[model samples]
Target chain A: MRAVVVDDASPVPSFEQVRSQVAAMIRSGELSPGEHLPPVRQLAADLGLAKNTVAKAYAALESEGLVVGDRRRGTLVLAASASPETDRVRRVEMAERAAVRYLAEVGHLGFPAVDAIDVVRRVASAD
Target chain B: MLGDWLSIVVLGGLSSLIFVSGLGPFTDRMLDRWCLRYDVAVDQHGREWLRTQLRRARAWRWCGFAVGTVVSALPMYANVIDRNRAADFATPANRFAPWLLAAAGSVVGELLSRRPPGGRRAAHLATRHWRDYCSSRWVAVVGWSVPVSVAFAVQATQSRDLGWRWSWLGPAVALCGSAAVTVGLRHLVNRPGAPDGLDRLVDDALRADSAHHLVGASVALAGLGTSHAALALDLGWLGLLVGMGQWLAIAAWWYVARQETWNVARVRWSRS
Candidate 1:
């Protein structure tokens, strides 16, 4: 997977940005199962984040069971453990989260709630 | 003497041609290997830039060869061929004329070869960055300075024992000259503006070039400084410690340069 980008100006914390990006890559199958992520220090330098931030993101991924950190080797993506129902529920949660973020962004752009919903509906139906 | 001059001219000209022709392809292959190892995908513009550098290198090599040959030949003729006229050329100034000529020729050759396609501002920024790289760390300065300083100190104290009032002059001149050349050469080699086609790749390549120059300058300065110190102190044992320090400095410089180049390439690639 490509290096994760963290925007300092964003409301999301840097660690969360790293965590969410890695998680999204995992769900999208871009980061393969058993694939090794870059070392924490390497990733931190690449992303311009503190070592603690990258380490925290990796720890969060471990807790979520998406990846495992081996002492000798590096961090490895774990084979996903979700059942089909759980996977569907996870997808729903991700979609709702994305929708909320989209709404928040559009709201700041002077988009009314009805117009935002209409825009989403139009984009979804067109897709 | 005439036979020696003939042999030198013939041999030097042939060697110079062979060296330049061989070095161009060798350097190109080396760059290709480096790119493969570092995962740097060179675009069309990068290739063009590499071609330009190779061409310039060949040109500079030939210029150096020609200038060196002329310089050596003049001294040889003065000292050997023209026995009666040797008195005039035997002065210290005349003896050192070849080196001065070669140095001047190299500078001119470098300037002629380093005419970048970019604008002045880009070239200025590039030169500034290259200078920054050369003198970035106090440790590097100290690394070159300590040995030379020690040599000067030793010379000052031992000048009476050695029966020379100006024993430190040569070492001082050598130290200052090498330092100046190192900084100047580094600035000359770095091309500032982005290449026309592959902006990112060219940028990475230029950075890698900067790193390579830094490593070269550091290693050369280390050798020069240590040798001058050994000469002044006349202490063979001190060589061991100095050599170790030089090696450590070289390793550190190489590591730093490699890290910088890798970071640049990685960041550029990631963005793309």
Candidate 2:
């Protein structure tokens, strides 16, 4: 169990920090596949987070295939390479959602929907 | 035939509340206005608030929804009314029980109130995520209504002897469907770099605030109507009617209040 900080003062969430730090730990081999992680509720208490915040971080990890939850055994790390596609999909999904939000903002402010779509296209296509 | 016609119209009305609320389009308009006003590409405050509220609302709404279910089901659970006795309103107990449950469910949930004042400044501070939920909650509301309407149909067709048994099915289906759709929508639309999710975090709070006042009013009306209808019918078939009315009133009121908030937020955002 590593120390996880809840940086309410920063715009970045505690979960983002946890995700990055945990990834760093995995990369450095300080944490390894098959290693068990703390339960969400316990970790939240340790980190001074709302339980859901910890759960969100865990969900991100789980979705990335960086971790897998064993019904009886709790959440354990998975070999990062095993779910490379999951990582790609997650990234794509994040990009898509962000794009949608951006498009939505543009459309709502009295821009034409087609124009908003064109803007996104041009921006993405640009260097 | 008369009863069937009545239930269909009533159920249709309930379903309509889910669709014609204009919440989604209205929310989008508001968000656009906010973005234009701020002259910023991203809605930082809106996103922050939405993420926070979605998580908080979801956890709490489930609890409230559960309590509402239990309260609404009390009459049947207590055996104060049964299927066979549903249509016969000649008895005082039969007449009052279902209405009592409907009112209880609607009003009890209302006791947990959150409303925001509608104005430009108040709106400027509103989040895009809340606005998003305001725009899209209809999908959730309408999705859940499918099962509810089906269950109501089943309850509508059952013979008198099977009234009580079938009566449970409508709400049982509705409760489960509502929970599933709500959770699914939350997950599917969860915003990254945001807290909680999309709608539950920010807009739901404002929605709760804006519409909190209507819970009492809806409960009073639905409860009174249901009780009266229950008293008239010996078979308790009218429980469906009362239930439908209560759901419509609350859902519609929630949509309207949230939409207004969303609109104001957009207007303020545009000017600011």
Best TM-score goes to which candidate?
A: 1
Model-by-model lDDT, in order? 0.54, 0.45
lDDT of 1 by residue, B202-251 (tens): 55455444444334434434444444344455556875776565456445
Interface RMSD of 2: 16.1
Supply DockQ values for each candidate.
0.01, 0.01
Summarize candidate 2's per-residue lDDT along B104-209 as a digit string, tens digits: 3333333332222111111111122333323344434534454545544454545334444334433433343344334333332222222222222233333433
TM-score of chain B of each: 0.56, 0.30
RMSD to native, candidate 1: 16.9
True contacts kept of each: 0.00, 0.00
Model 2 alpha-carbon drift over 4 Å, by segment:
A1-20, A23-127, B1-29, B32-159, B162-169, B179-182, B185-272
